[model samples]
Target: MSVHIAAQIKRVGRTLTANRAFLECITGVWLLTAATHHYIMAPASVLSQVATDLHITSGVAVWLVSAVPASWAVTNFALGVWIDRLGDYRMIALGVGTVILTGVWSWWAARQGVFSSLLGSRLVAGVAVGVIWTASVNLIGGAVSDINRATAIGVFITSAPAGFALGQLSTPVIASWIGWPASFLVMSGAAGLAFALITDSVRHLAIDPTTNTASMRANFTAVLQHRAVWYGCAMAFAAYSYYLFMNSWMPTYLGQRFALSAALSGGLAAVFPAMGVLSRVGSGLISDRLLGQRRVPVLQAAFLISLPLIVLIAWTRWLALIVTALIVAGFVIQLTFGVVYSYVREVVEADITGTALAFLTTAGISGAFSAPVITGALIEWTGAYLPAFTYAAVLTAIGLLLSWVAPESPHSMN
Candidate 1:
């Protein structure tokens, strides 16, 4: 019996080491996938072209971009519940396969000159993204230990903004040269490589079963009853509202308000996500260094600082002021993601961590999904960007208040 206990301890140590290595590789692939999806299929590039071809207004064209997050909101909840049962590798494999198939379909549809088929292809990609995002984050949280968890999660989540930034940087170039369809083909090939890497690395890990009906229900109930989970969800929702607004509408705002060309607007938009990637890493390091300190204050400080910057970017016409505001907003908004993830994980049990993450993701996706449609309507109604920016700013302030009110879980460094 003593020998068995000793062997189990050694095995756990080995698993921890393997998990860290696996997370490193997984984060790289995740960044690739995120950058491609955000930039290639993003509303700014693909939807703009498709809208022009279809003779639709910008308001309607925005749906193509909005559909991805909206679909993700619904699908992520289901996928989150099932990820443990399917195992991380299998789920990732399925997600990659879906991306590959959809990429080819997207390319073919673009070639066929059929707008509806292309839209269908984008929706298919959205489904895959929903599953991929949820499973990947959960996988990282499950595999890593508490001590290094925030840093690992910070690296992984930074991919979200980094991917968006890369998309902004590359989309215009790809669209101008080979055209958008060809760009997706390139992305498909990349997804294939990522799939191969993830599968190879995680093949030996244990797969948990999802068939335990009662336990699943109990887990959901427990998460629902947990205040920390709700607070995390609220924070994510507010942060995503800011992120989606920048991602979906910033280029159009530049084009409409500033009279910039698509290429130039895209270039400017790239800076926001680039700053976001850096901020994510910085915030995680801060959280790690201040572990057991007052993290809620740190979160509130970021929110309060970012609100005015976002408003300034939205309202200003000066090129220098606009650019500076965007850079600061990106840094501030993107950093909140890792902090929220760390907070939730600290509060939840390791066994049900995936479930907790799914709830937070759902809230974030809901915010992201709503931003485009609502912002489109706001623009349609007000004929100005001020109201939309104001709405986001107010939400950020509310998020700050919520952070203060939320009870810090025992898991916090404080």
Candidate 2:
């Protein structure tokens, strides 16, 4: 009966696949990719164990988490342009297959206790993230209908925070049983599953090589010159910087600042991403359905609401208060990705979506990638959470300012 019900669902889903299946499949894969991406972040979640296992300083150990996003930022930018040229199958296969290989390499490096090798493997994994992310964005923007596009992107963008929360929520339990290397082996399997779902679905569309040189350069310049791209990238930088700090180091901060145990800190830290799952979706719905496609107000409101919460989360001593502030902060802070994504589609020419997304990815990730290492340095220098949280509040304000500079596209003129 259960199998019969499963078959029935599959049949019904196939019928719906005409409009819904591709979006839904890639969205699920996006979520899973996020889970795998954040799993590497889990080493920071248990900083002590990693330091002990590798016999490294706390500073060096943090790089295990930092390296992935940094590499992912660069790789995402390069592949964003290439996705326009090389087509989806190559990127997806390169992406999905790259992670599977690199996961094993990461596991091997971990077992061998080779720090250099581990960093190299992590770089490979980050490339997979960049390729998959670029391809997925290009796919959704170019393929999906305009009417459902915002709604689809809203749900799709939730994958990042949802995956991070799942990784934080599950890693401690799984790591306790299997050790960290074996835990990553599990992540590899998850990546493989997501790959299976999307591999056959590539549209096989790509730019002609004869048009590549001048066209790519022209597209690059055009996307860079656009005011919407500037505002989008700038705001993304601020929003993602705060998010990267939360996803990568929130547990570490909680554990140190409050002297909480790993499991306990991980549990509490898990609250941050839970709010992100709601934020992007809610902002997307409000943009599409309620606001009639104006995205700036939603973004500005997020920054405004988040500003107080950032200060509140930082200044508070009470655990409950800190957690509550984080929940609110998480919700508002995450509105940028989906809202801005939909907004970007409106402002740019249809053909260069990949390069436009690349600019946003590169710029946003530049901010996100820097946060971990910079926050680490701040903590090293100040020896407290106050500086770090204060830094975050300042970042939120910058986002608020950028929102004002960013012109509103209540309606897509394109």
Candidate 3:
């Protein structure tokens, strides 16, 4: 009886410890991701202030949002081959450091009111962010068990929207308190704190270094040879294009269309990315538990459902209805994010997962880079918001088609 009781107590203690560790892991990952997002998105929240402060046109100011992704696309493509060799921990550390330094540069430029300098700093930060994104996805996907991979990643993916919401809701307030440029430095400090939280937790997640250049070449070749990767890229391109388009323009749209104050419009625009908090995690659960670990179907459904929602946003005149449409659209469209992150990792070999994700990042952020510029140009061309939103819906249709044909993972836990 004594022996049995002792064993039972030991098992209970182990369970508690495991549960605690799991919670810490989730919190650490979420916060770290959120910090990066807050830094990246802070500018979009105060674009008008930035334009006025720097004396640039709205056309030029839009590039402040676009420049990061533009450089991110190029950097992801160029640096992906080396991620496996450098390992996740080092890459993430480097990314954090780069952003911190860039933050200072941006703050100085903003104080000087140099548009070119501010823009250049954003472009440099984009390079760091690409590696950070690729490595972080690889880390999350590799950290958990196959049984819960999608669910864990789904939860992890929520950080993007959560961070976006945080930046949008907080940046204007922060700018009001300390001016727009200081928001950059403050967000970078937040990133530093977030990095500190995750540093100890993720140290064990670093990849084993590749042996040589030959191995790096092989990893790159292996990822490129996989046909499913191209399909995932197409899906990513569509999803990111739609995601960034809404995030970049919605505040401006709301301000212009409804004659809302900047604070009100920015707060309202946040509802779109905010929906990811539920959609990303829920999609992961639905795919893992309900869909039997099938990812492509979830991806397809997200795109299909989001198409009408994008149209609704374009066509609606009522503010309440537009907000409601944004809520649903944000949830539906963001389902693709967590699913694609998990899907790409599962389809590729473990050794080359980083490379596969790098490709996805490159393709997706290229869409992110393009969407704002294109939408702005379209709105300028047509002198209306309808054509811009229509362009987004068309992108969703393309993504839906791509998702329909994407190959399901052969290693499905189901």
Candidate 4:
């Protein structure tokens, strides 16, 4: 009897370890994909090339950058409903395949010198990215034990900014060396490799059980009626406002305002995201430790700190001060999501976790999508980035005000 009990404990321990390893592997793949999608294939590198080749202004080139987020937002709403039914592995495979094909198409478009075709390929790539990112987040969150869920999510979320940082740092160098078309081909190949790895590892994992009619109706009804859902959506918008603006506009701002080179601008833009990667994990760990206490205060603190930094970055002309302000703003703005996700999971039902996360992501993406256009318009109107930066600071302040109103999870309190 004693021997049997000891063996059982060992088996359980091995299973837990395997589960953790699996989650980590997926997280790594997701991070790489995100990095490639946002930084490498992102509009910034493409915008410069397309604008130069087509003799267009940066404002028009902004569409190439903005289209991906717009498509992502639309696809996420539809994809979220069907992702669980199709299975995580199937969704990943499909999403990766789509992205790979889009990369090939983008290369072809670039070679053919057809501007519209290149834009079309980007939009298609955006749709695939939307499916992959949303599914990956929900799948990883579901796979882990509740006790470790926040930590897993934190790690997963960190990959995105890490990827963005890497993308920003690498894209310009690659583009400078081989040009944009070849750079996109390399990204496509990487996506294909990630697809193969994830598909092989996830093959044996159990599929999420199909939703029944009653549960489906209940989930739809619950999400629609829940005030927490609205709050979560709002929080996502608030948290991502700064991220969108900084990631989309900051590189250009630095280049134009401070007379930095493309490589230098891209490199500097990476600092905030790199710092954000650490802050994201730290915030998650902090939230997990304080699960028994209050979550609102931590979230409130992140938002409040973000406001002053954004203001400083916008209002100050000093290069040293602007860099410092951007770094601080990046840390606080990116850190808020860790707490937001934890709060959402604690309040929402387990069955609809994907939908809940999808809604939040959609809101955030909306903010990201709209931010560039707004900033562009502001620049066109006022001929300066300060007004746009100031606008971002106001958005953060409003988000902080909303964070106070977000409902605390009853489960978290316990």
Query: 16-103, model 1: which lDDT tens digit per residue?
Result: 8676667646654575467446633444556567677667776677566666666778767666656655655567678778878887
Kindly give the number of clashing pairs for every candidate. 5, 0, 0, 0
lDDT of 3 at 405: 76
Candidate 3 lDDT tens digits, 228-318: 8899898999999999899889988999999999779977878888888888889889888888788988998999999988888888889
Candidates' C-alpha lDDT: 0.72, 0.74, 0.81, 0.72
Which candidate would rank higher by lDDT, 1 or 3? 3
Candidate 2 residue lDDT tens string, 7-49: 9999777656644557546655675567565665667656677
258-361: candidate 4 lDDT, tens digit per residue? 99997888778767767777787777777667555345666788888988888777777798888887788778777777667766656676666666767778
What's the TM for model 3?
A: 0.88
Model 2, total clashes: 0
Over 4 Å off, model 2: 1-17, 202-216, 247-262, 410-414
- Clashing residue pairs in candidate 1 (N, C-alpha, C atoms within 3 angstroms): 35-163, 291-413, 292-413, 292-414, 293-414
Order of candidate numbers by TM-score, starting with the best: 3, 4, 2, 1
TM-score of each: 0.85, 0.86, 0.88, 0.88
Best candidate, lDDT: 3
The regions of model 1 sitting more than 4 angstroms off are: 1-20, 35-43, 46-48, 52-60, 176-178, 203-216, 252-266, 293-295, 314-319
Candidate 2, residue 35: the lDDT equals 57
